[model samples]
Target: MADGKFMTAAEAVALIRDGDTVGLMGGGGGLMEATHLFEAVQARFLATRAPRNLTVVHALGIGDKKTKGMSCFAHEGLVKRVIGGHWVWSPAMQQLALENRIEAYILPGGVSSQLMREIGAGRPGLISHVGLGTVCDPRHGGGRMNEAAKDDLAEVLTLDGREWLRYKPFPIHVALVRASAADEDGNISFEHEAANLDAPSLALAARNSGGRVIVQVAERLPRGALKAREVRIPSAWVDAIVVDPAQRTSYDIPFDPAFSGELTGTARAQSEAADHARELAAAQEAFGERQAVARRAAVELFNTGKARPVINYGVGVPDAVAKLIAARNEQHRIYQTIEHGTYGGTLMDGVLFGYARNATAMLDAATQFDFYGGGGLDVAFLGFGELDEEGSVNVSRLGGVTVGPGGFIDIAQNARKVVFCGTLAAKGVKLATGDGRLRVLQQGAVRKLVKRVDQITFSGPQGVVRGQQVLYLTERASFRLTPEGVELFEIAPGVDLQRDVLDQMDFMPRLAAEIGVMDAMYFTAALAAH
Candidate 1:
């Protein structure tokens, strides 16, 4: 961090070698913006004769197979492989990768973070009480990049007495991270930056692995300037530092006013709650339709005709779904119910849960995983994406590549019957049946469902084996994954089978049930595609 040692973003990046695994920092547009630094390094590597086998890692995004903004490495065919927990990878990244340009792998957020923790601890890998007997199971190799990834995941071994999911160890050589501020002594302070994203954990892991740790900061100071109490990252672990003084200008985050052109909100996520208050009000108009579907799905899931009703739920539709069950006096169809508690529900909360709602109880993250891993959760409802002829849904990766598995594998595995509540092929696409009564179009077309998913957020294999009926609720049609391709169940009124459904998709699906018309109240909101 000495003054004279400073170099341009391009100069510092030249230090990286080919095939080196670099740990990057910063998740969304925040204080730790590593994009510019990476771009500079990538450009240096690409403009000259460089090694193609480069590995990049980060808490949130390594931009997967494609890189954008400042990613000369991702663009010029310099990077060979990439990995991350969340997929916010650049969409064009995977296409080039699939074309043999780079190799990519996506892991669950929590699991991936934990993997880095295990590395820092010097353990080969950590055993998890999460994502077992589900899509992320090592048996399927955790949906690794390719043959090599399969081998990396193949090392996991489940303990017989107590069930848990385990993954192999990954070594680290270099790390690229960002910081809000740092002092000459190396005491770092996030100053509420911890909540920004997962940079701290990635940096710790990189340092513990004996790898060279390079950090990008907004400023540097004299020897005792920053207080020890304010330091987030200690100087002992820091190897090199690069400073970018301005807030968003020196490193612009497009979505943030602090960084970028006129455009904002990469996914409309930052300040989404405040910015889209009007949208939420509109979504409220369709509350009746959502509530009705929730009630029906809940009743069906509750009345199993056998066991005591113990239910578990997820966010979004499941929150509304649980409300229906509660309306029925916790019906005989249900006894004790649980939810991830993301919505403002006064229900029992579990561990690792964000608890956006005022739930009855909340516990440690570890305890939540215990219930999830123990296979005690009953029925659940959630969201999803495209299901191929093989029934593989690519809900994980998208064009912007902000794909994820977030606690999905854990919930799906424990639930008896999982209800995936989402519209199918949204974009004014519609279908009709039943003497022409109901009419509707698809809404919320997620971009992840391509010919193949960049990552598997949910596993169709487990759904089929568990007798799980996947319901894709669209205003126009309801599609379910069968042993064959996804089968269309019913269609809305004013919609045609031949014109709307079949025409949009690149592939054909099994026609299971004759399309039926939905109710009248469902047509107010026109379904739009992402």
Candidate 2:
């Protein structure tokens, strides 16, 4: 404490005590991930096994879905419990949960992020309707993933004769956050990162609980290098800083200052644009039927007469929707947003899903979720791995793998309208598109539309109760979510309704009085343009 807050990752991690509740701050694609700090903790645990049975909390899917980030803490005795906002990126942890090796509880992204802020403010708990009728709801398993999870972390209460869900807050013993730079005084700034994410709230939560805040920074600066407004985490809230000088901007790229919007001069913008174009071109090479699904989803948005619609996109095919929108020169007509707080920019996909190719402005991750939880999104395009007769969607789990809903629940539930985009089936499904018509080369072995989804990430029945217009857009067909169930609304040409649609589904959907054919133009690569 006397020499300065700067320390090596191992030295900083030594402060974490056994049985401590550690709060982690990071989003998808390794954005603002304290990799060195996490690695140091893992190394220390393996060597000494001192900090055993620690409860870990994360607000998003961090890591590369393999051996990185929180996966380091997936050892049996190191982690006793996990309260996660998303689990898709951590397969090792999910495997532990499946084996009942650790207690696992999952909550919506907005709720978890807000819970940290409430904890910082010394609030009793977080009260919100973000997870009212979903798995996080007490009536629906209370967000528990396996039998080992037993605590009732959330409860349903009545206020003013209305129901609200309150998530109980726990004491934080350590907070690990990542930033772009930090002064020797431990003043943090995320000037070069894509988003600030949960760093601010995590630090505050640790400070309020009399815990230590360990930050990972790409660069260690002099005390006065950080401007007043740029200090995202104050020195008062920070306990130590670990500097990784060679830190890359994300998992894929080494460093791109244009992402931070700080070096967005004309020359830099042009260079970034060229690189973005090459990436887009490569992604489009494998578009295949994904193009049809994305175009159909985007057409629904383009048809809407609303001027400059406020739209948000999830990863996967939804990213294609953003590409189609930009290709059509309709980017200016809609205010595009990503859950990581980037707004009005070309949306990026893959490991860099939460970032933007070019952004107009960036806000705090919690503030972005506030807009989503408060019903600020007019339309949200999201990917679906599974959908059932009841219109429930499951992108969180499949075949023993748990990819938790990063921000899917918050965006899907709060948006005025929701479009679930994906293929009708997966795993070797083949189709050919030509002359504005599709030919079914082969049907997929896995039927995405089933009697019941393996897990309910987006509760369609809940969306119906909220009076939201929900649509499932697939390559071969489309369905509109009704209060009773899903109703078949459209089908692709050159496909048999019974063989390709009805027979493949586990449960029958209510057919529209006159089933409309999907626009023929959607069946070709031209859909991306015209």
Candidate 3:
């Protein structure tokens, strides 16, 4: 080791004691993930059976959907409990939670990130309206995933005749965080990382609780080599440092200068063009249902004639909306923001959902949530798994699976205009699009529009109370949220209102005064043109 604070991954992980609460900092796709550190912990536990019955907490989904990130802690005896913002990325951890082998709780990603900051500052707990009336509320299972999660981590409190959800704080015994590099004196910097997630907050939470902060870095630099502004976590906060030269920017990507804002000028434009070409190709292949929905949603960006509107694109069909905007050369007309805090760039999808190529700026995840919670977004396009007659949308728990609402609640509840994009139904649904019309070849067995959702990830009634303009866009139909309920406003060219839209839904939505047909250009390759 170069110094007392510098050590191998094994040595750093050895400092973690049994039954301790470990806080991990990473988002999906292994952004800022300390893979070697997590692997060392898993290896040590398997060999010695030590560090048993640990409690793990993470603000975002951290994994490659296989054996990395939270999966390394999936061993039954290794982890006794898990409190996370999202769970779908790590199927192994989800399995553990599903089988009731571990106590599992899911909170909103923004709430989770801010709660860590509260804990670090020695606050009582996080008291906010972020999760009110949702699963995170004490009245609605209190963010508990399974029967094994019996403890009440959230409570409903009334102040000044207003209801708010209070998320209780807990001590963190160990913080496993990652950054791009660390100085010889143990100051951490995230110069090469895509996002500076909740790493600094987690480190502070552990250190203030009389615990340890172990950081994994790609390389080690001499003291003072890093600029003052580059040092995200000061040396006084970091206890141990583990250098992993092979650390990747993300799960599948080794290193990309575009992701870290290192590319600029013509280089940035060329990189973006290449990425757009590949995304355009992929979008063309899957251009039937989702593409139509995205095209309609993209049109909303120009609604109300708002110039340079700030927008957020959630995963799934909503991500396609950004690509459509780029394809039209209209990206500069809108400011794009991701939950992970990257702004204004070509957003990546799949495992790289939180990152962007040629990002304009990167804010810490907690601060980004602060902006979102304050209604900084002019519009937000999100994906939905279920839409109820009451206009509520469910994306968290679907088909007997627990896919926690990552940042859906925070963004949906605050954005001035919320547009949800998804297929009318899922599982075996097929469509054919040509000649400026769409034909549904097969109906899906699953009806996404239901009488009631499995969970209330977005409360339609609450949105109405806040006076938010909400719209639901699907392949064959479009609906707007009214004071009464969902009202159908548009249908596809080749679709029948009764058979294709109404009959497929579980309940009847209010009919618009005058229903219109969606633009035909959206159904063909002409959608790429302005």
TM-score of each: 0.63, 0.96, 0.97
Off by over 4 Å in 2: 268-272, 279-287
The 0-to-1 C-alpha lDDT of every candidate, in the order given, reads 0.52, 0.84, 0.88
lDDT of 2: 0.84
Rank candidates by TM-score, best first.
3, 2, 1
Q: After the best TM-score superposition of candidate 1, give how far the Cα of residue 463 lies from its true spot, in angstroms.
A: 6.0
Return whichever of 2 and 3 wins on TM-score: 3
Q: What is the lDDT of residue 84 in candidate 2?
A: 86
Task: Please provide, for model 3 over 42-87, each residue's C-alpha lDDT reduced to its tens digit, 9 standing for 90 to 100.
Answer: 9999999978999999888889888898999999999999998888
User: What's model 3's TM-score?
Assistant: 0.97
Q: Considering lDDT, where higher is better, how would the candidates rank from best to worst? A: 3, 2, 1
Model 2 lDDT-worst window of ten = 278-287
Q: Which candidate, 1 or 2, would have the higher TM-score against the true structure?
A: 2
**Candidate that beats the other on lDDT, 1 or 2, i.e. the better one:** 2
Candidate 2, residues 397-503, lDDT tens digits: the string is 67856567778888998999999998888888888885577778888898888888877888988888899989999888899999889999899987889988888
Judged by lDDT relative to the true structure, which candidate is superior, 1 or 3? 3
lDDT of 3 at 384: 94
